[model samples]
Target chain A: MSSHSLATRTEKTEPAPARTRRTRNRGWKPRLAPLSILRLLILFGFGIFCLVPLIWLLLTPTKTDAAILGDFPLSFGTFDRLAAAWQHLTAYSGGILFKWMLNSVYYSAGSLVITIVTGLLAGYAMATMRFPGRKTILTLTLLSMVMPATVTVLPLFLEINAVGLTNTAASVILPASFFPFGVYLAFVYFSTSVPKELLEAARLDGCSEFRAFISVVLPIAKPLIGLLAFFSFVANWNNYFLPYVMLSDQDAYNLPVGLGALMAGSPALHPERGGSFLPITRPEVALAGLIVVIPIALLFLIFQRYLVRGILSGSVKS
Target chain B: MTTSRRAAARSSATAWAFTAPYALLLLAFGVAPAVYAIYESFTSAKNPGSLGLDSYAMVLHDFRFWPAIGNVALFMVIWIPVMVCGTILLALLLHERVGRLSSTMRLIFFLPGAVTGSAAVLLWYFMLDPQVSPFAPALHAMGLHNSIDVFTSSHLAPIFALVAFITGVGQWIVVMFGALQGIPEELIESAKLDGAGPFGTALLIKLPLIRKYVIYMMILAFAAALQIFVEPSLFYSITQSGSAWWSLNQLGFAFAFGQGDFAQAATVSVILLVLSAAAALFLVFRTDFFKTEVES
Candidate 1:
């Protein structure tokens, strides 16, 4: 909407005689005409604050423990040390680090499919259909959406365990799949973007409810689907607390839980577990940390537009 | 018309069909667990003598409760202002399209949000360690010999708050950056025509335009700060001083997971829900977010 308006304004202003004269009259530009050196420095300073640690995270894995302590924080270590860290990380607990990464993939992918499907169905139903309990459904969705997610962890653990689902992937994937936030996002998105007449036309043409959603609505709703999918996937992937509470089997732990264990002073990462002489070291844990981080960074790099829109959508409502 | 009315009823049934899966989930996970948590908070340990407010009484009187509340209270005071002012300043700077370099700076600033929480905490854990930290040389210059000297009882609060600032600020920057982008360019251009400098435009014009988001950020930041856990939790694992800087969620998490005291844990969760519910209610009434559903 703003882009179209902006294009029109540029069209109108570029041909005006005053536009050129105004630019020509402004004389003597500094290094950055719009900003002073101090302002540029402040922004750069904040940029460095955000970046320095991540640079260290990347570089630390290349070095030995002593070198991590002694060398320049941003300097590279030998490829030999990097290979050794990977070897040690893989050797620990028969390469459970890879197992955790696989488990994370399973949990996040499963939950992503469920979240998108349920959110779209519910959101579309709420937006287009007249039903008896629709208001109550919408109200509860809003209320629960605003409630802090971690608030129910203890009771959810009890609920999951009472039914004998704990320690299974079901424990993590099922609960994480119910994305109230995504449901709300879809509901709001459909209400604002999709015209009522479009769907009504499909109904009047004798299309079945499911057929209409598949044939008519889904084609026009690609962006919304992408947005909801990205949001829920990121949330499920970054999930640490719930899985930490639910899954106790060391072998079943997802990436966050397993990486946390690898870092923990606990017995799981202990050398005694495998009778291996090589204990997990700083570089190994750092490498494992980088492994846990890469997929998410790639996901963000790929689907950044929808992800940014999904996040900023909250700002508008608030 | 009578036949068309029947068609409407049939379609409404179809709508219910579409909503069934999510509705079932909402009941099973959201409603049931919340009700159970409330019930459990008032009872004794399962299969105990009788039901009473014993858990609530115990949690309220626990030595950890008041101090944890005070600690998070102190955190809220520090975190909220930094979140508000810092996000505004950083976002305003980014909104100014200062050549092609601004885009690179934006990505650099935003990359931290992509970094995992565990990694960020691990980095800070080492960053604050005096002996092996990257800041060690500067720390030596200052004559602070160790983590203990730096994270002493009096200094622990700011240290925790600072870690939060470093990690938490990026997401808000991204949000406020989006908010700033919504302001019309004409205003900035007109301000330039009126001889307003960048600072004046940001302070006077742009700031007033995004006042709604400023308040929104304050409320949301307060909610986030109240639930502070990960940084302190990780720190405590190594330092054994988790109790000294017990944020509310950390304290409750310890009681729940560490000690296996579910009733006290549920009480803390319930208190958080009530507080969050009040904030949610305020938002619903203040903005017409709910009204849009009815109108549509």
Candidate 2:
């Protein structure tokens, strides 16, 4: 029997009329069913929900505070207004906004380095090696992945304070490097994606396991590395509570804490707080939010290709 | 025999060497602070050296404690399942049509996550206001005429749930879509050959295949939601409608920074840690999350 008839045979258990309907609708251009239309509408609604606020945000910096309150929410103002907003934002506290951006870079980069090195090596060992405490380590990593950063912030502050390291950049970077999620991601990737036979073949070719990992494994793990780096950088860069409690000096603050402090001082966001002489109005605040958002969005776009392939090996066979 | 034994010993040594740095970090940052938190929870300022349960009693007795728990419970109830279901459904839709349009939609969904932490709360503060929000028409239609109407205590749960879902569901879509892609094509082809339609294939084959991933997402999302701090804290700052102690972490912050009661703070932290640990450990151990070997 032909495959088409066999397929129909498999569908014989269904009611007779439904089978004829299915066969009749089996052509390439199936009619647009109600379900397909509903799916399209739902997806279009999702698109609008996600994009509208971002579009609003992108336009806010271009407009004046008065325009932001008065004009159409999606309308754009002028480049002159955007430049003015940037000028007012940077002029606050002697360009502290730029300093906060730099501080964010330093802390995020430092932690990213540590997270990648330790997470990659440990994940490789757990996936490929026969170690005594591997299961315990893996379980602990899973638990730690879900543990709230707030739960540890106070205790970590106390620990760092005891070591006389509070208010230092190390206070943030050191703790942030303990990224159990990145390690877990790497573990999942290595165990599922990398074939054991490849490593074994390398071993038989007179390659030390460590040498093989450095040579053969590292080359193929580029996408995983990118995925790990992107996640670690985002988490460290956007982290607020840890740095908020750890760093007391204003000069040491990262973007989130700095912007928060700036907002607290502004009368626009906090109406109860009286206005200051600083020119940080609604436009300037929106500009600051954009400053904090642009880096991660750029990174996401650049590394997204690697992201899809990074987890693509979820069920790959050896 | 001697060579193989020596090789085994050498390989074991290599494994330990590679693993030591991360182990030490976990010990220092993860285990050490938790141990210190336990110790601090028992030691109070009234009796500096003596260990007691007074701090725990103090935290448990606070009137704000239970309300905070209830608020978080309500938020989680509204947030987690909606976020999970929305993520899976959106991912399946995106998987249905693989083209430039779907890729662009994916990018749009993930865009909100870029403005995370306090910035996200800040953005949503503006976005929910009927006066300036792009959704002003919708807000007015919903009978929220101003910020006052927008931020009532009764409305905070859904508002925060929407915010969290918007910012979070995108990343999981990427993840779930990847999980869908990981299903071997032959299995799907065979199911198709059995005359299964798209909906049946999704429900019967794809959903079951990604069950473990969904469970994993739920556990982690639950643990994260249990300690909802940034949304409530930032919102409280702007609105001042609710008590400052609106969530567990906020309460803990009040004890630690606001009142300098480290003991009480540590007690709260310990309670949160235990709750999260119990939930996580129970789920992780119950599932195949730690299974090193994949059958495929």
Write one digit per residue (lDDT tens) for candidate 1, span B1-296: 99999988887889999999999888888888888878877876654767788888888898888998888888778777776788888888766543345546666766766655565566666677675576777777877787677655555567777777776676677667666666676887799789876678889898998887777677666666676676566656555555623877776677777777877778887787678767766655575545565344
Candidate 1 CAPRI level: acceptable
Q: Model 2's CAPRI class?
A: acceptable
Candidate 2 TM-score on chain B: 0.89
* Alpha-carbon local distance difference test for all models: 0.74, 0.81
Instruction: Provide the lowest-lDDT 10-residue window in model 1 chain A.
Output: A2-11
Compared with the true structure, model 1 gives a TM-score of: 0.89
**TM-score for each of the candidates:** 0.89, 0.88
State the DockQ of every prediction: 0.48, 0.45
- Please provide TM-scores computed only on chain A for all of the candidate models, following their numbering: 0.86, 0.84
Query: What is the C-alpha RMSD, rounded to one decimal, of candidate 1?
Result: 4.1
**Where does model 1 exceed 4 Å of error?**
A1-35, A266-278, B1-4, B46-50, B137-143, B151-155, B288-291
- All candidates' chain B TM-scores are 0.88, 0.89
Q: How far in Å is the alpha carbon of A67 misplaced in model 2?
A: 0.5
Q: Which candidate is the best by DockQ?
A: 1
